[model samples]
Target: MNATTVSRLTSFAPAAISVLAIEGPRTLEFISKCWQPNQGSSVLPTNRIRFGFTKATDNQPRFGCNESIVVCRTNHERVELHCHGGKQASEKILETLSSLGAMVIPWNQEPCLLARDPIEQEAMEDLVHANSIRSTAILLDQMRGALSRELKRIEQLNANGKLQEAVDCILQLRQRFAIGKHLIHPWSVVLAGPPNVGKSSLLNRMLGYDRAIVHEQAGTTRDSLMERTSFDGWPIDLTDGAGVRLASEASDPIEIAGIDLTLQKAREADCVLLMVDPFSGWTNSHDRIYQETQGKRILVRSKADLQKATSVPPSLLFDAQVETSVMTGEGILELQSAIVAALVPEAPDSGIAIPFRTRHIELLNRLIGL
Candidate 1:
């Protein structure tokens, strides 16, 4: 073999001779008959290593298909076999071992084995289910005791009786956890506005695809449609809800109900994008609807291309506003950046630790009160 291959083979050789305890009434007879190793090594008295050929009950050779395994008897009553990794080959070996009265047990179930720490276990689960590179990194760090180490430090400081300092540190970390939790699990952003205001159009722009129906008809979207999209590494649950409107003579009961449901969803959302046509400005109806949404709200001026001016008017004052045109894909990038800036800011140097679970938040709150 080449140098590299020899080095790799040598590295794996020690681990290859794993000791598997075979105990039963037929253990000694089976080991004496089937145990054969290709290499010639003297078998020690009580602690012996024998190179051997394995065969089926029919006396057909099974060693040709499988690599020759090492059978070692380290005790008077039991034998150990080091076998290959294929499932069928392992199964056949195991069946042979069992027929010789060996009791099979998984390595993980062995007593006196060190159990994995909770954080390590959680990390394994996170790695298995992680959907993004950033999330996986965060989870791996957490599994490596990043959060647990911090908690332990906090506990130590508190034990020294620096209660106020400990409290302050935990409180700051909790704030970070809030943002981190959202980063790991995106919050819901709902678009709610009167019909024909380009809500659906904006939805298509945000998702970079036509997921919702966009038409001139006022009540075209009578039900909410949801799409998952990410903005600057932060996952977002973007929902295009049925347009809200004052109950009119022509409005059917179903349409009215849809509007009410849309309003309710807006009230419960993490952020509400109240879309309006810039050319039309904010109408009295828009003002009334805006007053009803309880969550974080931002005014989005749609159809900016049709507007005579590009700037926000002096009379219109809001926390934030974005001018966008879904038709030409203008200001979409700016809108996405603004959304990320507003919702998920960069983590501070002190490190923000947001709870990944409701249980964590609840426990934190209890600890805070104490």
Candidate 2:
């Protein structure tokens, strides 16, 4: 209760403003020494942002720069300093706290308990660095005790010997956690195929904009391009990788390198969209590249408007297949839905309770075993 811990809680990526968290029972005392509130009193009220300026540990204005800072007091034990995100402002804040004997650390190095309970702290920690709005919403729900409340209920159910209900709860948590685990890191989906099969076009169509360059030139894409977007409230990292082709057809060493990199991306991607020109029918390269992708794959007949074949042959052995046209926008929404379903088979509703960390689930599983 007496030990004060200070940490820079916001991202350090050269933003317009930054935030620093000062926590512990002695937080107000240390803050009073360095931060002078505009009202001329250093005592902060709970849940209110007090305007302030940075001062030295000896209670003197460090400089005449007259910095405008908004300080939020969550409680007597917790204070958040919102200041200009520039390097100089952050340095002054950290220097002042360190000079006062307060433990200054990075956000990640802050102590585990951020709030009164574990889930609230975990969600707050994530919210500070959330990249997308969808991720922020999901974490905000967790902060409302959605996951913690659910876990406690399951624990009681298990203790009451309701084995079936407990099992169902555990299974649900485990399933939903897959999506929760990717709050920061988007789920990766790779667009892969032979050159000029409309992989780039499909990517553009999905994004509803010209994010990927579309052209008739083979091997136009010499490297992977990534785009970030949310599908059905789930964040996705759509990667447009270079098209894989046979050595005879793709002899350019640069394109060959790109193709090799594409293969590796497909192997690691959460879902692979194997696009083929339906007019061209099934090619040997199609099967060869399919074999290279290790996990979930969707065979897509691209340029569906130019179909010249009777139908997709069963011998092609596609696990799942869809026809899409970038020009006419045929099957684009359906393909997007298919991709979402493939990556997250079961979609979680907003505010659904799902563990965001491995330890949270592990502890629940341990309880089930007990």
Best by TM-score, which number? Answer: 2
Worst 10 residues of 1 by lDDT: 2-11
Candidate 1 residue runs with Cα over 4 Å from true position: 1-114, 123-134, 309-317, 348-353, 366-369
- Backbone clash count, each prediction separately: 10, 1
Clashing pairs in 2: 17-85
Cα lDDT tens digits, model 1, 296-367, are 667787888885553433564454678889878888888787776667566443322334555555555666
Each candidate structure's TM-score, on Cα atoms with residue i matched to residue i, is 0.66, 0.83
Candidate with the greatest lDDT versus the true structure: 2
What lDDT would each prediction earn against the true structure?
A: 0.64, 0.80
Candidate 2 stretches greater than 4 Å from native: 13-17, 25-29, 37-49, 55-64, 108-115, 128-134, 208-211, 247-252, 307-310, 315-320
Error of 2 at 349 (Å): 3.0
